[model samples]
Structures are given as structure tokens and as C-alpha cells.
Target: MESKTGTTRRDLLRAAGLGLTFPLLSACGGLAGGGNSSKNQAKSALKIGFVSPRTGAAAGFGEPDAYVLDLAKKSLTSLTVNGTEYAVQILDRDSQSNPQRSAQVANDLINSDQVDLMLTTSTPETVNPVSDACEAAGVPCVSTVVPWEAWYFGRGAKPDQKDAYKFTYHFCFGVDQFHNMYTHEWPQVPTNKKVGVMWPNDSDGNAIRAALGPLLKQSGYTIVDPGAYTDGTNDFSAQIAKFKAEDCQIFNAFPIPPDFATFWRQAAQQGYVPKIAQIAKTGLFPSQVEALGDIGIGIAGGAYWTPTFPYKSSLTGVDSKALGDGYQATGKQWNQQLGPSLALFDVAAAVLKAAGNPKDKLGVANAMKTLSVDTPIGKLEWGKGPNANVVATPILGGQWIKSTDPKYKVDFVLVENSSDPNVPVAAKLQEYKP
Candidate 1:
């Protein structure tokens, strides 16, 4: 897959004016497609723009992006659509973990590059803005990694509306899945059922506070929310004090990595220790845990993708174990984001083939509206409920412990799978001592 860096004035005009694919894309200009319009308009190249946070705070979500892109480029040398062959170009831009940059790069991809489909992942900071840009430009977009509700509702897609965003589609776990996993997983730690929450004043934080908080309360767990705080707040003293006062044994948070690290270190210093500190978003990566030293061990969180999964990548034909092993061959630790990063391309391949004519924007968008495709994670089928545009994937609960292997310093052991029976529990849940 070729990357788009820039285009000359002539190139821009040609890209802007052309109703047909570039001449270089056509393999002998074979007439391939069923419909008359498709026969007349089967373009040669399909361009997809990918947005992610390759730098800044959320960089962990994008560390393996380049490796995954290389894998996709190798696997998908060219796509055979109908009877014609079409080369694929994936132009990726880093959001740098900033939302405004996300919107700006997405606009550039949509306007300058004239991408047919847009695929973005990481967090709402990246996904929401990119999706918004796609929705406004009438481009087809598929995003994962962000919570379904945060992407769906956080972007001002009304809950009561019959149709959510028309151009963008998302696939990730939702509040219901969080409720199911939390209710099942937390009971194993022998806590008092009091959950001390630090939901930030952001997209992910707001949605979880409004939705997951209530579910936890209804499930007989007392909630100790300290209200919403701004993202880079240094002092968590007041919040820690309250949790200590209430004897909150189960700590829950949905914050950016730095904020979480700061709060966690402060909590340890102030003696507001909990029995089960279940963190989301921040604790998914091994690097995040490694940064905390011994304090990070025994901390629990959800696993969106692990080597234990039985699913295989459609493009690479490598199962979860092989994918992990392949990445580790580079002497780097395996990350949870690897599966989702490559899965974005997997979804792109599916929709491109389903579009009939890869050049047709509206047709490709419509195809993504109801798509069932395989990825490194699992089968992602849209048009099911949580919302019309979302597919809730399985999230397994696990804890970070000292690694038994020499190659790694920490290991994540899956302790609960009631949310997903297909994945077996890796080990028993341990109570938090630090």
C-alpha cells in the first residue's frame, strides 16, 4: 500500500476532476463488474486514509502501526475487484494524540488525497475528530479501539435518533459489555463492592460515568465518584481523601496515561490503597505498567486483544500467537494495539471488495453499513445493536504480574471470561496489595 505525502498542482487537479481511477491502477483496463455504472466506472486504485496517535501520550496505541502497515502492504499487494485488478494505497497521518490535528489530517486526506475510505483508531481524541471530518466530507470511515458509546454518542450522535452518523462506522465494546465484565470480574477480588471512580471530563470519561456508573450501582456496588476533573490536573488529593474516607476497596478510572500514573502514584503515597484497582484505557499496554515498577503489578484491566485469542488475520493467515511472536521477533514487547491496527486494514479489504466498484464512494459507504469481515481480533459484523453503527467486541479482564519468562518483565493473566466464553481464563484473580 502506497503512502500519500503530497501532490503537485496538476496531480491535485487530476485527483479532483477525475471520475475514474488513475491510469496506472488499471491492469490492461479489463471491463469487470455486474452493473452498467460499475462496468463504466470500475476504477483501478483504492485509496484508504488511516489516522492514529503515533506520538504524544497515546503513542502506545500506535507503536506497532508502522509494522502493521508493512504487513498489510505485503499481504495486499493488489486487490482483484470484479475482474479488474486495483492497487491499494493507505495514506496514514499521525494525530500526535491531539484531536485538532486528527481533524486537520483527516480533512487533508479527504480533500487533497481524495481517499475513498477512511480508517482511524486509538482513542476518542483521534477517532471522534477523524470520524467527524469523514462524516462531513461524505467519506466512508471505520474506527475501532474507542468505546462504541464514546464514539457514537460522544460525537453528538443522538441516542434517540433512528440513524446515527451516516458516513462513519465503529466497532468496539460498549457500556453493557463493561458492565458485564466488571460485574463478573470484580467479584473475584473480594472487595467491598465500593468502586472509587475517576472519570475525567472527556469523551470516554463522561460516557462511562453516566452509563457504567449506574450499572455498577444497580449491581449492588456503591459508587464513590469524585465528579469530573480536567485532563492534566496534578492534584488528586481531594479524590483520594474521599475514597479513603469511604473505604473504597475497588478503584476504577478512565483517564489518559499520564493522568492515571500521577493519580496512582499519589494514591499510593496517601494510603488510599484498594483491593482491586481496575483501570481501563491506561493499563492495556505493558509499557504503561512497566513505568510504574512494582506498584503496577497486580493492577487489573481489560484485554481487547491477547495472544490467547483463537482468531486469525484474514490477510496474513496468522493466529494471535503467531502475530505476537512475529512482532516480538523485532525484540519489542507484544502490545494489545497490534491486533486492532492490522484489523483496520482487514476491514478495509473487505469493504473495498464489497464495494463492487472500489472507486464508488457511496457504494463503499453503504457496503460498510452492513459488513461482516474477519480480522486479527475476530469477526466484526456491523448492523447489530449497541447502536446501529457499532459492533461490540469481547473484552477480557486480567492483571499485570511479574513475568515468568525472561524476555518480558511483566505478564497479563486473564482472570474472568463471563463476557466472552470463547477465551479461557489464564489464571485466578489476585487481590491488590500495593
Candidate 2:
């Protein structure tokens, strides 16, 4: 193997006193060191593989992917590394929101496409399996959106394991975040402090059940767990019946999107509506709640990203307002995926440049281990994160408020930002009347 050692982009830029900016690889300008023609003539180019749930129950997460990818393509078409201009190609695949399929596509990217780096996001179903594949294949990977505790322990990793997977790095909130977002919202409404928790047998459900349930108990609230059920259980009558029997005034759940939609409708029909129905792993997006019609109003969940967030994209220098405005201007609703998806590319581009050798997988992996850069969500400090290979993003409380706006039938307002005060609170907490 050729020697994979040289100056990193961060080193060169800092030496010149230029902070992290994308203008170094300007779209209209020629290559940094060599001309554009030489970049095309390079024998090998840097390859990046992106995987997400584009066409499945969780497809809402990938709705803004195309726009973000288009932005990435334009900004990352070419870059200068160690005085050599290199062409960059990004390969995207749909995980279909299935763990098995996620692993398959990830394997193809590593072995077949020989991707120099891998990036996956959205949820544990997409992030965990893809990260596992990258770890087994020894390919450097980065992921986002999934709760950190779920991504770490959900993969059967222990808290004492430390750096369980070196080649894979993740950035997202953790179980503590969910607890914070929930406890902050639950007390706003009058209740008996009895929380009805519906945790399934899946990764998210198991992790939340283990951590979040105890936290609620410690906070002097009674937790009424109905036990773990399968993912696609058509009937939640038993669980609903238990909550109703216990007179649970506050409801919490971590379930798949479709499963929550089914259980939510059933709960309403069965007259088991709680004063505060805070859900996780589902109902984060507007479209998901829109499916619930008016019942979606007053439902609550955690928010990691929002159009109203006060942050900017490192790639396009686009602030949260511009990013959301651009999407809305194009006839598309704003989504949480926009920030993290663009952040993935921002981190990817930074990792590739910091690697000093884009073709060397080990070098790229090492670069990702300590890489830190500002993103549309905020500054991501991978090195300062919870684990050696993780960065904990902020999670705030939010609710879906009734609205007649055409852009969105219901408005996803930020109700609590105690965890991340930088994000302004958009509305006051409203008790769930359903």
C-alpha cells in the first residue's frame, strides 16, 4: 500500500486562518492546487455511500434526502487533498427501513462499490445494521438521528465496552434526552403522575424500556408498563385496557410509526386518551401526525431538528431559516431530516479532507473518530461526545398543534427547549383533550 500520510484540510485551512468553510472548493472555481482537467484524469476518485429509509414506513425521514443530496453533489463535486485535486462520487441507496435490507445494501457498498466511507441515518432500523456492516467490513462510517443509547446498546454493546466499534461513529441524542423532553412536557398538564408506557420488543423499545422507564419512576412518577409486544401487533386492546384500568393520565411509547398510528387510533376509539401523550420513535414528523387527522393535535414528542432551529449548514452556509425557506419555496414541507442529512455530507466532506488520503479506509475512519464541525443542527463535537465514537445532539420537547395552514395541516411547534435553549420555544404546552 502507498503511504497514506499528508497534510489535512483542517491543518491547511487553519494555517491560513480560514475557518471551516465550503468556499475552498468553490463551485465556479477550478481545483485548488491543480486545474479541473487534472482532477478528472485522476485514476481513482473518492467514493461515499449513503443509506437511508427512502421507501418504507419511515420514508418520511428520507423525503428531504434528494434536495440535500443535490446540495451535496454540487458542493462536493471536487476537492483538494494534499495538493492533489480529487473527484468525489456519492452513491445513495434505500434501506427500505428494514434491518436486513440495510445490512445487504451496506455490504454491497463496502464490498461491491468499494466505498471509501459510509454514512447512514434516520433510525436504529437503518443506522444500527448499516453501522454493524461497516464495522464488520472495517469501513469507516458515520450515522445520525437514532438515539445514542439505542444505537449503542441496541447493537448489544455494553456501557462499559467503551469504544465497542471503532470504525463506526454516531451523532444523536440518547435516552436521557427522551427523559428530559418527556418530563419537561408531562408536568405542564395536571395529572396523577401515572405514566402508561408501551415499549415494544424492538431495539428502540427495549432500550427506552430499560432506561427511560426507571427515570420516570425516580422522578416520583408511577410507571405502568404493559410488557413488551411484537412490532406489528394489530391489536393493542390489552395494553389500552391496562392503561384505562390504571387510569393512566400520561402516556408514553416508543414504537414503529405504523404501529403507533394503529395503537393511537385504537386508544382514541377505546376512550383511553391521556392528558399528555408523548411518543418517541414515531410522530416526530408532520406527515406522520397528519395521518391521525385532528387527533394528532396536542400529541407530543422530542425534537432534534426543526425549521425554526437557530443553526446553519456548514456546507452551503445556509442558516436554518434559509434551509427551511428554500424547501418551502420549492413546494415541500420542512422536515427534521434536512439538517442532519446535510450535516452528514458536511461531516463526510470534512472527514475526507481530514483523512489526507481519501482512498485509505483506515485513515478516513481515524479522521472521523475526532472530527468536529458546525452543521445545520449546531456544532457536532465528536471528540467531546459521550463515548469515543459518539456525539450527543440536543433533544427538545415539542407538540403538534392544530392548524389550518395549507403547507401543513398541523403545526409542529417547539414547546420545550430546556435541553437546548438555543432553539426558541415556539408555543406553550397544551393538554391533550382527546
- Candidate 2 segments whose C-alpha is farther than 4 A from its true place: 1-44
lDDT agreement of model 2 with the native: 0.85
TM for candidate 1 is 0.90
- The 10 consecutive residues of candidate 1 with the worst lDDT sum are 23-32
What overall lDDT goes with each candidate model?
A: 0.86, 0.85
Task: Report the number of clashing residue pairs per model.
Answer: 0, 0
User: Which structure among the candidates has the greatest lDDT?
Assistant: 1
lDDT of candidate 2 over 158-221, digit per residue (tens): 8788788879999998878777877787777889999998898988888888888888789889
Model 1: per-residue Cα lDDT at residue 5: 33
Candidate 1's C-alpha lDDT?
A: 0.86
Error of 2 at 155 (Å): 1.6
lDDT of 1 by residue, 330-393 (tens): 8888988888888888888888889898788889888877899887778998877566688889
Off by over 4 Å in 1: 1-42
